[model samples]
Target: MTVVLLLCIITSQLTVVLSSAGNFWTYKGSLGADHWHLDYPHCGGIRQSPIDLQTRDVVVDQTYLSPLVFSGYDRVSNLFFRLENNGHTVQVGLNDKTMMISGGGLGATFVAEQFHFHWGAVDERGSEHSVNGRHFPMEMHIVHFNKKYGNFSSSVGKVDGLAVLGFFFEIGRFNEHFQEIIDHFGEIQFKNQHININSIPMIDLMPARLTNYYRYHGSLTTPPCFESVTWTIFNETIEIAEEQLVEFRTTIFENDKSDGGVFMDISDDYRPVQCMFRRRLYASHPSLKYDMASPRENGNDGVSNQPTRLLFSMFLVCIWCILPFFSF
Candidate 1:
């Protein structure tokens, strides 16, 4: 089967529309972040996301933390994906069974549903979550739904229903793998436009170091801003070329240029940092105190079941090799 056909079948089973109420929400003017709560109550909730993560304030709790783990994230063969320009953000949907995460401070297994990004008009500020009030050029959110809560839509309304792995991006060397997604941005320049890509090395998008991270409870950055997320922010940042950053900021939000509607630039899709109520942030690594030691270098034994990963990989490889021989 073709990649598009496969993606259609997969999306039919896992797609979810997360738009807000009747009124539309943008990042500026009246319908901006300051007024989102007027339409979506959860946007004004106390446990909102995009908070400034202060290193000095965060407590070091090595006992309750685990190394971040990515399961089935290294799919490089016979993989199919769906990319959509949902007006609000550029979202790429993936099959849950193929990419998942467990451990690494997450109490339950979460299935990868989709991943999207939030960038700025320039390189100065774009990241939603900042480190000691320092913002990066852009931020990527790898969103996952708790397996126990069923699908992505169902999980959003319940506490502990979602897990978002956030990574900040700095302008530097070119990321070739990330270009696969960037190259297709033209096709989905308008609202609701979607296309299927052959494959993307999802693991390559993340930084090499996954051991050091911050853990906290928060809500969705967009409305309805459901406070049902377990957030994990990595300490390291991904480097992308300046040209790649330009491609992202140039994406349009209108359905067509021919229409009278203004061609809104999809530059600042990120929400401002919300107030950090009384929530305590936890770090996986040891704090800079006068006593405790850093976590074990190799403690992050990803995916506890080695046999399961091997068996799943073997099964996928076998299927890939014989796929052409059989009719779907």
Candidate 2:
């Protein structure tokens, strides 16, 4: 019995060490965005993403920021999509080669790779990038890689390698197209879980108009925070029912079932707005205006001010380091 207990203790200790080490970054706690820079130097770089788009400072560029041309986005295919819960967010892989985008000042054609969402715990806030410091309930990012680089992985580090189309969500009537996605969430409720979705035209998930938008050079919001994305945030917001928003907040878990079956909700999977520095934010249309009188203007900019729990994390590390010494 003593031998069995010792073996069990060692196994538990190893599990704790591996879990802590493997998950080096997370949305909150000591390993959150504020501490990501310690491991990924680019997270601290000047060109980081999810900036508060202050409309008052935007530069109107209707000339070069022409209307984006989307090809094959509306085409319904027989190819199924893989929807997954990657622990960070729910992502849908769009492997179709036909789906492509160009124009809107993009020098080369870009092909769709995948799309994912970032949402808050409630309907009031969730979006990564806010307009005039006002956050929407949710945000969807359709990621595309520049065709010049050949594939998504190859284009990740290139300056002009990726273009991400961002759309905000507001509470309103039910969205049938969005429902198609939500219906599959049950299959991917746990981290690393995935399901195959029937083919649906990608256009169904987009806003009605794409002419009005904000553009800027930015980085991926996630860790290894590569400063390679050309961001296009739409002026129009997608409407979904309040219940649907709740479904998103409640349905997914960041932890797998095998990890003690702990229920950790995957909401608020977004990084706070980074400093814009000297970067220029551009608008496709001159008429796209924002309300300067937004509540966020009063200084509740939605950026988290919570101090990093570094000391606590170090204490846990020390415990893990000493666990092996306790064994025979």
Candidate 3:
């Protein structure tokens, strides 16, 4: 191992790049190293930002409970995103398997509690953090709750009970799976009222690479951007065509209904990058036995690491907005 590598291992702070080529990590953001306040209630002592991962501590964890199932789901109109009345918080219903993450140590379990997103102007990059100084078109956050913490209500005020995973969205081919959310984009409240639909399953809203990603600690990109979350970013990014991007912009209501589109509303939803602050980033690079690691999982295993678990990207933004959701 190299000198820096040994230091990282000794200090227990290391970050490794997945690679120069990947179907994953397309979600990496394009952000500047402007500023981040640790004392700010939004991101203080416990707050952490996106950190790269290296090959050291990664194992297949399948026995642990994962909350990305077809639980009960809710359907609410997104018209609220465009109105000028200071806008309301994103609405949510429920599902069978969705859960949240908790800071409960390395082997702790986290469930899907809620999901949300942050975007920016259609003209600029929308992700909150950048990778090697690169940004994507959009980013998704799949927030989870540590079962030990409590539900959405009990956990919000406290940090000990939650962990959030973020994924970047870039422009590419069309995504048929995302159409479900796109179809419902117009229902959210734009004026005084909109429609609320039935609950949906969590399985349908995720990318194919559920087990592949690089995880770390970070803060909420939105205001009151809490510093409580266990961020897991997938190496792969989902693809969306130009027309779909345009449709997304139009369907999503913005401050100016006549001008800018939905993309405009979410385009600038990103917050600036935060400081590394000397925190260590852990990585699971598999056993280092495989030639090229899986593009969609944190790392792959051969034998002893049976019952391998898949790393899922909480793709609940864009279509869902304040609420957790995926895109079309």
Candidate 4:
């Protein structure tokens, strides 16, 4: 009888130890980004994301770059989305439809999966991808998977299998596009709370200029930092009132408040910019001449008038051929 009781006690102890070892990740402390690589190997990969987009360092290859094409971003005819507070951020899952992206220089078509945001406690900094090391109030990422790969799960770990569109938002005019989302925040204040929303025009959530953007090859900012994504960041920014931005902070990072775990705020939940590793950053618009001595703000008038060296050489050859023919 004594031996049987001891065996039962040992089994219970081992079960508790194994269960605690598989705890999910959080934004701070033990399970934070710094230690994510310990459990998820890809988190320490070479080509990570949320990189700084230095205007001068980026190569302006307008020849290969093209305007981003969206098929059914409006989705007026569909009521297919559910909002969820997934501990890290507020995510909106979309139902499969005509909503997809094909162009914008993407080699293949990618269907929308979901969208989420990264924000800060204060307006000084929040965005993941910074322009010239400047952070915005918040950032939105629309995630998509290459249709060639079938679904998001199968597309992971493959090259060019994902496309993520990023947009920066600053405090300005009230964004009517975000009102519906803000009003529903109360229902999802805790983690894992999800509710269906009648309608959402996903395109309206993006910046006005879809053609003017930056592109690069990088990994997902969150674990397991899979390096299968093609990133598209718009030069134009969207706007949201300060009041609406604050509502995002109310969401908790803890899965359950009654579990006696420390409560962490979801603000400043963005990852820091990773190393570029000499990777080529391409822009769709004309190149901006680098002053080197003085950095200039990349305002609306930043496009260069000077033609590319390759284009100029081709023009010269055409002129020479025409001159020789006329002389003969």
Candidate 5:
């Protein structure tokens, strides 16, 4: 009788441990990304995303990576969107089916599905995919599915099923376009909270230039970690005010208010850079100089001319000094 009771107690404890390990996941604590493989097998697989983009190692492929064509992104007057705090990250569901993208080495047209963000607790550590070992303040992913697959749901596991456009964010002057989305933060202060937004042009949220980017075949950054994404990480970054970043870090909670649990802020919700085993990162433009920290002027090469300007300034100073000595 004593042996049977002990055996039953051991069995119950084992069941509880397995249940907790399998169900939930988070960015930190025991259920963090490090332990995710216990529940999700693909999280530990090769071709995982959010790898550091070492620019020097990238292959320039102008022939295959032509400029991408955007369609229906500017249409906004009659469109509707759903913005929600989904316990993990803040996501915006794209309601318009007309918005689509093609080219830039993607063989098939992909219809836009939804967009979401990954951020850190502070301004310096938010972005998921880093450039030359530097993280941006934030990162945005615009997800799409191959038109041939019918919809995002049916396209989950195929090699060419998904195409995700990634853009990084930097601190700068106020962005009026992004302000439209930020204004609704109050309504989604808790998890599962969502609000419908009307008339926001999808084009306004992206950088003006869309030609230069880095492409690679990788899995989704989040779980189930499907190795189906054809990633196009733009070389240009979107700018937002520092105050707006604070609102993202502070305003949203991961748990619902009705749960009567300790409220956790949904910050630092990005996965760490994964290993690149045999994959090659490709650059769209051959001569494009990639820099995540510096600012680029509109309608010019992405490289900064600050060093050239400094050289010219020194030459002028030398000429000025000699002019006084050579006075006639």
Candidate 6:
């Protein structure tokens, strides 16, 4: 049988596909081309689906707040500011007092992991999925973990228990302000190694209309293809210069060129889009529309109210879902 692009490449194990676009490893197979779909022979398991996450719609009614304050862990990454808690790089903590509704899995405190970018080698047109059938320069995923689970391994190969924030990147000139992330790309020194990087702010890398993202329950689109996380993809596209995309991907050798005759040059690291599985979609949450639903008596024993580095406009909409779920 001919394998389909974007979806339909099926097997019992995860496959890592290396392309000029980047390196993507998948368990349920991956898309060969952009916007491709496939028959999901394996669906319905709690930890099966990879993309297009769906869950009970939780309505957030109360005001949301979290610490924009955070630090970066990786050096070569383009994430201007990121936060980590319980091994997660970017995360948020929400409690009942600050929460409002429960249905689509909102009001849960999820930790932010390392933020990264994806781009084409030459420039223009590397991301999956197009607007009105149009593709953009790249896509950025601000991955997160559900504090309810307590750890990544606990939530591993699992969905309905996590959240991932997605945003599209358009090609343009590198914003001078955006360079804060670009500045440190050289410091990372190597891949897979992490450090406690400081001073990066989450506010600088965000758009103003964070409340207006499309919410859905999707899989990690990575290995194990667990349909366990919630996705909030913004309708708006952010701009980064063609040169900026270049700068973002470029990596330096850990040692001096003279010390070792060969210092490896690295570039292009990203996870590709997985099968859509023709999954059903859900309606956006009401509290996100800035509507405060009828108040529930705030319980004293609930998630604590905390600020976030990248959990933009989210705490208010996610407070209610925090109390109902927990993983150890």
* Highest-scoring model, TM-score: 2
Off by over 4 Å in 6: 1-107, 193-195, 252-272, 282-328
lDDT of predicted model 4:
0.79
| Model 4 weakest 10-residue run by lDDT | 12-21
Model 5 lDDT on a 0 to 1 scale: 0.86
Q: Identify the superior model by lDDT, candidate 3 or candidate 4.
A: 4
State each candidate's clash count: 0, 0, 70, 0, 0, 46
* Per-residue accuracy of model 2 over 1-328 as CA lDDT, tens digit each: 2343354345323322222244368999878887776667677777889998888668999999999999999998888899999999999998687899999998999999999999999877899999877899999999999998999999999999999999999999999998999998898999999988987898888889889999999999998889999999999999999999888899999998798846999999999988776689999887775546534634767432222344456689999999998966
Question: If scored against the real structure, what TM-score would every candidate get?
Answer: 0.79, 0.82, 0.57, 0.80, 0.82, 0.53
lDDT of 4 by residue, 1-328 (tens): 2343355345323321122135477767667766666666676666789898877767887767888789988767556588988889989988755589997679899999999999989998989998877899899999999999888898877878899999999999988889888888878877778898866778878877777788999999998888999999998899999988988876445455555566666898898887676478888887432423232364625544233544677699889888966854
Colliding residue pairs in candidate 2: none
Error of 4 at 23 (Å): 5.7
Question: Where does candidate 3 stray beyond 4 Å?
Answer: 1-40, 44-106, 189-194, 254-266, 286-328
Model 4 misplaced stretches (Cα beyond 4 Å) = 1-23, 251-253, 260-263, 287-328
- Clashes by residue pair, model 4: none
RMSD in angstroms, all models?
Answer: 21.2, 12.7, 15.7, 17.7, 15.8, 17.7
- Would you list the C-alpha lDDT of every candidate in the order shown? 0.81, 0.86, 0.47, 0.79, 0.86, 0.45
Model 6 alpha-carbon miss at residue 31, Å: 15
State residue 264's C-alpha deviation in candidate 3, in Å: 7.7
Candidate 1 accuracy as lDDT: 0.81
Better of 1 and 2 by TM-score: 2
lDDT of 3: 0.47
> Which portions of model 2 show Cα errors greater than 4 Å?
1-23, 289-291, 294-328
Per residue, candidate 1 scores C-alpha lDDT tens digits across 156-258 of 8889899999999999999998999989998999888899997676888899988888988999999889999999998889999999999988865634544
